[model samples]
Target: MKKNQSKISIKDIAQELGLSITTISFIINKKAKNRISDEVIQKVEAYIEKVGYKPNSAAQSLRTGKTKTIVFMVEDISDPFFSSVAKEMEKLAFDSGYKIIFCSTDNKKSRAIELISMFKDRQVDAYIITPPEDFQDEIEQLVSENQIVMLFDRFYRDADYNYVVLNNYGSTKRAVEYLKNQGFKNIAYVGLKTELSTLTDRFDGYKEAVREANRENLSLLISFDDVKSEVGNKQFEEFLELHPEIDAILFATNNLAITGLKILKKKNIQIPEDIGVITFDDRDLFELHAPAITVMSQPITSLAKEVISGTLKLLKRKHSIQDKIQIVLDGELIVRKSS
Candidate 1:
């Protein structure tokens, strides 16, 4: 029988250098701080280079009780808005010594719950959740367990958690009022259900905008569970057959707005001339279009940095922040040809 090659262990390194395992482990892990001689450190470093070594993250996490990992749970990764946010977050988190894992729930409550449980079981250092529902008890349990949790882009009035979000109500209201200022009378609202507080807030703003403009006859179209691209196309086709007099549209999210753009192209309707458009979340598609899109642009860079910074602070157990405080960053309305 051929002899098998045994993997090198910290014990082998310690024995070879005539040092204790604890000293070897500490030196390998870069925890050497107890006035160890430079000569011994050099010897260990030289030996480590001679032998190819790989550190196991799981083992290190078990020893230190910190994985230095963050979970970013979003409603849908397919949406360009959320994808951009995730990219920005990954960049910032990586720069700050944290690895980020993304989860796309597709706006399903069950998937959201499953991802949260998996991350918790894996002992993720922190979570930045744009959850599918207002999960108060689960989040509170996380907090009680000394896990850092931060909510982003959505708010639950009853849950006491750290959060960073846009000024949804104010921004949506402003977008509508701007359309009204441009003389759009029959503005319609297109969106999904109210599982997320941002949706509810945007709806509230839409109603407020209509009321403030004294447009009582304005139509409110709610796209129940399905408001995705295909669903929006079918809904819009049916919507036009019934309510063809709508002069403008205010999309609660950018995906709805993009879908609306496609529908308009199909109907051969000119934007801002025949129908005006405004939506939340701006991206290159909206920016570079012929009739450039008007949008409520969230401060993504600032938001990403703030969320990560807040999460890290919580992880370090530095200080207890003000409870139920909503950091509502103002959104800018970038105006172009499409209202």
Candidate 2:
């Protein structure tokens, strides 16, 4: 019979090196510290290297009770902000010997719950979530089970968990203030109507800015379900027609900004001439536009590093982290002609 050229197992290495399977496992897992002699360790290590033996991750996971996998759940994997951060995080996690599984929740509670359950079944070592609305209960359950979880972008107020997020309120407030200072009155805020803290914080910032400036607050909060549809575009068009005096608009997200820009283009409203625009998240599309869009750019790399480090600390049990760790990074205001 033709031999199967499957991966070389720990057992094969152990037998060839005249050592016990336990010895090989201990060394491979880096658990033999001071327990095994250097001579035997060196001998086994050399032989394993010579034979090109790679440990079976499935078996190792079963023995160690760690899958070395991280589940990254975001509102939308295709969103530039999430995708950029995920890419950086994936590289960092891979360097630390962990794999990341990316999933999009589409801001749907049911989809988030389903993804969480699926990852749990596969025994992921940790979860990094940009949670949807009303996900506190599910997250609290994960935390109760000692499952490592790191919330990103948005978080539930009632849930205590590790998170790395931007200063949403401050960033939006600053962007609005910049517009107000530039003589843009009748500024309108465009955002999704969602209970997620991230959007709410941004909305609060816009309201606060308008109030502080002694200007009337104008906003269009589209339904989360309809934000991407023709209904949303029509809503924007109606909003503009309802308030022809709106000189500037701040969109709470990149996608919202994109939609608003498209509406403006259709209406032949020139940017910064008839309407000034500023968006919460930065994107290449914004930069490539005729008049580049000013944006509140999140520190994606910093966020990714903090998240990866926090997750690794939890997985390695390196230190006793607080019950809940909250790391809020600042967003940079990238000035452009649009604003």
Candidate 3:
């Protein structure tokens, strides 16, 4: 504890901990989730405390709320649905005098919990989360402490929190109903297997519509872990092989639909002739596909506006609100050559 010690910059801490300056920077700035090991974060943070090193940003945040930063945590940043929403909200948030930083939770409870805990060590003014599995207790804790949180994509059915999501049940139901009207028999559902409400509601919707239409409720639920692996491809292939009667498919997510298309193409299956296809999310590539894939397009612009405006409203009235903000938007069914 010398009075005139030279300023201990990030370099000193980096070398002392045997880690890179970038890693140190990420940890110091509370941006190390999923990229840096938790053990490394602990070691680096402990050393910084031991050396009495304080980042200027940290000090300033203590004075005025960390420059009004918001953490928009979603399942995966690469997903077109989530990415589009983030892009739509970025400028709106900044223009409102707040900064938005994105982090992928990978739909893992452990990852989400870690990100939630990081807010404990720093000042993250608000959170727009597409949460993973069970984290009700963590979310409730945030609300108890007067933190700004907005849940998107899916929500906790048992927990009351502000959220904006699509009409998962109705959207899938209508899509499947349309296919049935078009003489699509044995319609199969393709989607990632998760407890997420978004996918679950879609399945329920499809299931109900198929039940009423007197059609078999056929579905292939791929594991979240296998979304990118060949295992998923094999599963889908096997499902298709086992169910040759399937004449139409309603994919739950964009990536799942992409996988379906690739497999179908390799098998020389013709769209709208061999099988009709409809995906949940809209993307540029979907329309650019050979047959111009059909889709249930979400309200991307409206979603962005709702989430950002809702966040700003929540931020303005941090803790005095009694009622929760809940919004559910409808999806548009865009028919194309594929269906």
Q: Write the per-residue lDDT of candidate 1 for residues 10-77, one digit (tens) a residue.
A: 88788988999988888878788675777888889887777765556788899988898999888877
Instruction: Give the candidates in order of TM-score, highest first.
Output: 2, 1, 3
Q: Kindly report which residue stretches of model 1 are placed more than 4 angstroms away from their true locations once superposed.
A: 1-6, 34-52, 217-219, 229-234, 238-245, 318-326
1-339 in candidate 2: lDDT tens per residue? 322325677777778788898898889889888989989888888776676666778888899888889999998899889999999999999999999999999888999999888888999999999889888888889888888888988877665678888999999899999999999989999998988999999999999989999999999999987777999999999999999999999999888888899999999999999999999888898999999999999999999999999888777772455555789988999999998
Error of 2 at 241 (Å): 0.9
Q: Which ten residues in a row have the lowest lDDT in candidate 3?
A: 1-10
What overall lDDT, based on C-alpha atoms, would model 3 receive against the true structure? 0.88
Q: How many clashing pairs in candidate 3? A: 0
Clashes of each: 0, 0, 0
lDDT per residue for candidate 3 within 155-183, as digits (tens), equals 98888899999999999999999998888
Cα misplacement distance, residue 127 of candidate 2 (Å): 0.8
The TM-scores of all predictions, comma-separated, are 0.86, 0.95, 0.81
Top TM-score prediction, candidate number: 2
Q: Model 1: what TM-score?
A: 0.86
Query: Candidate 2's error at 72, in angstroms?
Result: 0.1
